[model samples]
Target chain A: MSTAGESGKGVGGLSTAKRRPGRRPGSADTRGEIIIAARKIFSEKGFDKATIRGIAREAGVDPALVHHYFDTKDGIFVAALQLPVEPAKVVPLILAGPREEVGERLVRFVLTMTADPEAREPVIALMRSAMTNEQVVVMIREFLTAAVLNRVVEALGIPPVNMEVAFAQVFGVILMRYVLRLEPLASIEVEELVQIVAPTIQRYLGGD
Target chain B: MSTAGESGKGVGGLSTAKRRPGRRPGSADTRGEIIIAARKIFSEKGFDKATIRGIAREAGVDPALVHHYFDTKDGIFVAALQLPVEPAKVVPLILAGPREEVGERLVRFVLTMTADPEAREPVIALMRSAMTNEQVVVMIREFLTAAVLNRVVEALGIPPVNMEVAFAQVFGVILMRYVLRLEPLASIEVEELVQIVAPTIQRYLGGD
Candidate 1:
């Protein structure tokens, strides 16, 4: 499946439906283009410093068009970092599989989703922004808490803290591998890493 | 027991012995002061953009003084991030205890080192610099490879890749806890976390 197309289409439908004033009528693709620009600018300048006008200029659209498309920078960020498959949507798929393999599925999902640069950029952008900006950190924390972590914790019926620590370990490995490009970890085969990390993740999921 | 003094004294003695021209003989504390300033500037401006003159200006010393103390920007970076104790020095300390407990010691060392704002600043500075600057990433990768990681791998006799994976997990935990300050993980008590994480670290250190 075209994850990229799915991600864009999902947001595009939502924005067009909102039909905020000044959203150009014929510019069906305007929202998508603006999102592209937003991701770029936000990644470069981070969350706090990236201005709406700058994103609009990058998209070659007016500032009003940006406002029409996304109400606030936070709105744009939610849209920009939001992946094609929602955590809520994917969690059931993950949960439907064998109970014991959930950890492997989760590990493989993140590693595979972020395996490519095109798909990885938005994730990295969100993480990097969260790292440097306190405002963005809160927003991201709220987003993940709602969309991903909390859902997974509830599904497994595990302690939230345990799930968070599990996520932190895997999340850190991903950042080091993809973002920091740390050696050995960066170059190791995906399946090999999955094997090494999956068991620890399993323990985190259900271990005593 | 003063890590700050140890870090300063170690560098100062080396700088004075190098005896580069403009090395002010009377300025016994010049190396330490420059490191403090370097940590601040590198953290704020990042590694590639941070300049010797800028560091000197911040430290209220001459640019030549920075040059005398540190032969290159890389040198200052190494000195700045280099903790009070070297890995070579600490590896034996970590290895001297019960073999199974090494993981606990290593995990505790990193968590405790980064817990303090003053001690954590240089580490966070290096990590933040590494995140944004490719040059600094390579420099840091090399430093950790030689000074800490390689030594740990040697001591444990684990596959280098396994050792790296282990480090990445703990390293990521530290980044989230201290730098990003991710919730729950951030607030979780150190010993509590040590209990939660030590087993995983042990498995990485010794498990097949």
Candidate 2:
């Protein structure tokens, strides 16, 4: 997060040396920096109040570069929140298998997502933060609705509440396993978790 | 918690006026003071390290009164952590009905426990604290195993891991509905949640 733009205030941000103007589009660290900056701005102003311009200023990059990387405000927000996988990408992965296997697939997928400590940290951190921050809850609720849960609900054509419950069950498992590190759940193999959880998840999704 | 005994540094605790040797057995507020003191000591010294004598000292009471009130250290821990229902109390309730209906009863009971803002606060606070503190998580896990989950596991004859998974499902619901307030899970009717969740919970318990 560049304090330079924040201190100077409004538009003409940071040094001329730092402004790349979409030149380093392939830069990974720059993408990471933008996400870090976006996280701060979103936490401070919330989703609706935050803008591409503000996030760009905070990242010490031009607004055009933000658009070039993320394409839209929601994209930036998703990046900021650090979801385990791309929302656009995860839907197809979840839906590609047989309808009856959706629950197992989902359990497997989520367990896989959290298996990597680096990937799991932000997701766990989001849930952890949401416990204390209402603003974080609102941000998470909005993101879950717009990016992840709603699409799955639409694809499955189930009641939204039912999907939320299904999500809750799986989400709880993640909490127990990853955050709480509740034993046996934490150490239990992925295949075992899928067996124990998939049927219930399937039942919630309107399958047997 | 009484700071008087905590600072005085020995067995000679509090004033003669305050130390009633098992005298107000029915006094509700004193019991509350003891629990509050236990929470502080448990947080400070951890579960194993915390002693009934120390807790009594902190509450400015006789150690005999602590035993009279709680029967054992584990009982005192349960009271301190504030499980929504008693561990000794809740298992009978969860197991009293038809096995098929166990999930319904469990979900309904948990939801009811959290429905009251007063009762819900400590449970939610424990979870919130557990997210940040490893000591709190250890205390919670030990308490859950001894007080709640193991009894149910033995009652139903399911594997311990299976029971933990069932708990993860319900724990997740409590988190989503109460802590995170993830709607419509947060706003949905209790009966509806029971309907959505019972079957999954039932499955985890080796029912149906």
Who wins the DockQ comparison? 2
User: Candidate 2 regions off by >4 Å?
Assistant: A1-33, A48-54, A57-62, B1-33, B44-54, B57-61
**Candidate 2 per-residue lDDT over residues B80-133, each given as its tens digit:** 877556678778877997888888888888877778888888888888999899
* Candidate 1, residue B203: how far the Cα is off, in Å: 0.5
> Model 1 chain B: which ten-residue window has the lowest total lDDT?
B1-10
Which residue runs of candidate 1 sit more than 4 Å off their true CA positions?
A: A1-78, A82-85, B1-78, B82-85
Weakest ten-residue segment in model 2 chain B by summed lDDT: B1-10
Model 1, A149-172: lDDT tens per residue?
Answer: 778888888877777778777887
Candidate 1 per-residue C-alpha lDDT over B108-197 given as tens digits, one digit per residue, 9 for 90 to 100: 877776778877777776677666777676656665676677787887788777777778778778776775565788898888888888
TM-score of chain A of each: 0.66, 0.76
TM-score of each: 0.71, 0.81
Q: How well does candidate 2 score on lDDT at residue B127? A: 87
